[model samples]
Target: MVSVLTKIFGLTNIEIAEDIVHDVLLKALESWKLKGVPENPSAWLMAAAKNKTLDFLRHKKQEEKYARQITPLLQSEYTIGHTLNNYFSENEIKDDQLRMMFVCCHDSINEESQIALILKTLCGFSVSEIAKAFLTNDSTINKRLYRAKEKLRELEIKFEIPVPSEIEKRIDQVLKALYLLFNEGYSSTEGESFIREELAAEALRLCLILSQHTAGNIPKTLALLALMYFHGARFNARIDDEGNILLLKEQNRKLWDNEMIQEGIILLNMASTGDLVSTYHIEAAIAYEHCIAKSYNDTNWKNLLNYYQVLITLTKSPVAELNSAIVISEIDGPDAALNVIFKIELADELKNYYLLPATKGDLYFRKSDMIKAKYFYDIAETLTSSPFEKKLLRKKSNMCT
Candidate 1:
């Protein structure tokens, strides 16, 4: 809808388009409450948005100016009350959304602006939701989106997709935005819950959309999709009925979605067949190995350790090193893993990162050093914002107390 609306009204008119869509949604809720959902709900929504757009143009006295272009656009039978699904086939929607993502995440926009635009235009996130995702105030997020849209409007940037020659350079930024979306859903750095499946589902939906677009469907794209799928398959089983996080090792394998796992394996194979052996592909490979293991004891920790070792080389990030340390703790021993984890010079990025302390707490717990373990857990308990995380840390604190 963002794509189609932006194409019609131009990026400059996105705010107006959004308001119209919101009004349509409000009408839908009121109408559906009494009338029930129509047979073709999507078509109904599209027609409503179109009608709203027309109303806006007429109200503003722009109908006469836009008549030549608008008349034919509306007359097309497919543009009428046709099945909206027909307009948004997997391939077409993929291309449109990928183009939209690249546009929103363009290098011209800073990361703050890029993410705000994605949350607003693509993911249907409210200001509060985006603010919570970033662990910032809602006013801060609202200002960011307002400033971002103002920037786009002020620059008079084209709403259309970039040409083929320019796509290669822009794809990385697009992928980065998608990755952020998934990470927010998976960990939820600040929220009541540890995970938000709505956000995760939207991220996976966008990635799958990317994989179907010819311009975006590189091997790396397939790898990212496969990675998301493999991890997502266990999303439900990752939490208990009580809303506590069930660590991956303790999750019930029987509840895992086998079909998603199969699809992930297929996509991983396809990604490998292509020339892209990106870090994501390797990570998916690691996760795939984990999922295939029948039980925690059956895990191939040695292979995962090897994968993390290489990942530390490929991405040279502190988090990767931290992850490698965790894997080595499993394979070699906490003592050895401690040597590795403590040796890394990760202060610039990780000093305030809660996971650093939480991970250290786990290692210390395993070593039966309850005093140090509680201290690290205390640090994590303070740093993390999720209520679920606090509960988990308090549980650990209780164990030591």
Candidate 2:
């Protein structure tokens, strides 16, 4: 609704569009209490918005730009109803939202602010919720959003889809934001729940929209979606009824969503057709290998190691190198993996990363060096803030006794 209204209002009055939507919702809350909710609630809301728009036009001051812009469309009741109906339709809503996402991810805005704006506007996320997702304070998120909105206003960016020539560059920003959102859901940094499936679900929903559009249904997008689906397939088994984290080795494969895994495979196959082999393609292939493995011991460690090598070459990310070492532990033994681990820690950015310590703990435990295992786990316990992770580290540390 905000997207549609912003489209009609010419981007200058986004705040006003949001205000009108709020007023409409408030009216619904007040009236529905006495009227006991209308049967055609959607139609009622559209009608209300239409009437509210007309009312604003009628009482507008001389310099109201939106009033002037929409006045020509409100010459009669029929035109007003038609225009509102057109905007309120399902297809229009989806298109408006897609375009709104592109606008939110405009190059003028920084990546953090772009994701922040997408959460707030397109995903109906509260400022506090977005702050929690980002592991930051509400005031910081608010300031970021304020700056992003001001930038959009200052630039007067169009509220439409990008041209074909610009789609490749523009779409990556959107994909990055969505990937971060899914990762947050898969492993929440600062929440009671280890997995916020709702956030993951929302991200998947938005990605599917991109994967279906002509400008967006490219190989990279398919690979990203495949990665999301492959992870999501195991969501049910990733946590116990008591909300305890279930390591992949311990999760019940019977509980995994086979349908989703199959869909992910189909997407992965589709992704292979294009010339580009993005990091997402490698990640998705690795995830697909895990999804197809019958058990933890049956996993193709060599295949995953190869993908991680490619990933490291492409990204040079310490995180990727750390993960690659884990696969090496499975294939080559703890000593070889530890050598790689030592090399990875030379990078300054990963000095305090808990996973490095945790990986070292696992390798020491595998080598039956309980004292060194406990030592690394102790460091890991201090490095991580997650309650689930702390508990897991304590369990590992206790094994040394």
Q: Model 1: runs farther than 4 Å from truth?
A: 58-94, 192-195
* Residue 129 of model 1, lDDT score: 80
Q: What is the lDDT of residue 88 in candidate 1?
A: 44
lDDT of 1 by residue, 127-234 (tens): 888777677889998888888888787877766557789877787788777777787787663563432677778888888887777777788888888988898888
Candidate 1 colliding pairs:
none
Give the C-alpha miss distance for residue 332 in model 1, angstroms. 1.0
- Give the candidate number with the greatest lDDT: 2
lDDT of candidate 2 over 185-210, digit per residue (tens)? 88664563432677788889899998
At residue 230, give the lDDT of candidate 2: 97
What is the Cα-based lDDT of residue 273 in candidate 1? 77
Query: For each candidate, what is the lDDT?
Result: 0.78, 0.85
Residue 195, candidate 2: C-alpha displacement in angstroms: 8.7
Worst 10 residues of 2 by lDDT: 187-196
Question: What does candidate 1 score on TM?
Answer: 0.89
